[model samples]
Target: MNAIIVTGGDIDISLLENYIAENKEDIIISVDAAITKLEKINLIPHIMVGDFDTLSDDDRLKKYAELDVEIVKHDPVKDFSDSELAVDRAVKVGIKNIAVFGALGKRFDHAFANILILQKYKKLGVDITIYDKYNKIYVKSNHFILERGKLWGKYISFFSLEEKNFMEKLEGVKYPIENRIIDNIATPSLYISNEIKGDKLKATFSGDLLVVESRD
Candidate 1:
């Protein structure tokens, strides 16, 4: 089953609410302080995972406890972040597709780490996407097609995560690329701010590609 993870970070509540409404069958997971956000929307997560160090309302947690929400609490001094813990819990439950909310905000480190989690779990055969109001981020290592009308945002960008340069071909976008070498270190902005042209955008790349769909 698909899973939706709510973590402790800035989020667009209305967007999240709409997403949850549309995917009612998907599993919901709350991470620590993120419970407060879900509580505001009158949504109770199926599973809660975190250390609870940042949670402000202990009473709310107790209320979930009364309802028997499966809470997997971790030690405060743990190696993994709360977001990671929540993702791990979803993976343990055999969730192959995961969408993460509240993963981007003021804490750049946490946001970066959460983005890395997409790549980490992708190696384990799980597909994870980090989503916010304006951006959707994920990692892809193969050919993919993004339909125009259903795209997450107006602009799509790609960044190489490989150490060595790799060849890539992109089509059906404003700026199409044909067998171009993408350098991981140099010319990082070579593929930023590309807009899809017709019905769909197709990409075929050699190495790991960090894809970011964004809108201003």
Candidate 2:
């Protein structure tokens, strides 16, 4: 199954929310601040996962539709990022794939951490993608297929998130690399701006590879 996690990041209506508004049925799982974004869209979350610390102490929860909301509260003492927790819950509910929004942040630490969350999904054999106004990031472990219509960030970088870095590859991209190894360090900004000349952008990996399909 697939799910959508709405994180507390940027949700500029003119930029990214339209893409989300159209796909209403995609499970709307809100994490912390994303609850406000859901509120702005006049949509209540199907599920809310986060420590209530970010919210108010008042009974603000009753403002939504009949049942208020399905909230999964966590401890303020835990170290897990809200996004990871939400993704974990989705998996427990039989969701194998997830698309996250409002996760990439305006702050460097938050945005960087959000990108780093890709590692959690990688270990679970799940395909996860994060979207913002400027880019889209995700990963693939086994063989999968993608068509031309999808363009992520201004640049696209694929890396090996494996020990000894034994399984990283890319195809249908501007700079196609052979089966190689990449590290945890930030990748070089070279593989950006790749246009899919036609359909069929494919990649297969032995370990884990993160493909950041970005826009400039």
Off by over 4 Å in 2: 14-16, 163-169, 179-195
lDDT of each residue in 1-216, candidate 2, tens digit only: 567788877765555467667676677788876787777767677888888687764456555434666788888788888878998899888787788888776767877777777877678777778877777787667666777665553355655556434435567766665765455555444344555554657766676566777666
TM-score of 1: 0.96
TM-score against native, each model: 0.96, 0.82
- How much RMSD separates candidate 2 from the native structure? 2.9
Ten-residue stretch with the least lDDT total in model 2: 183-192
Report the alpha-carbon TM-score of model 2 versus the true structure.
Answer: 0.82
Residues 57-92, model 1: lDDT tens digits: 678778898898987888999999999999998898
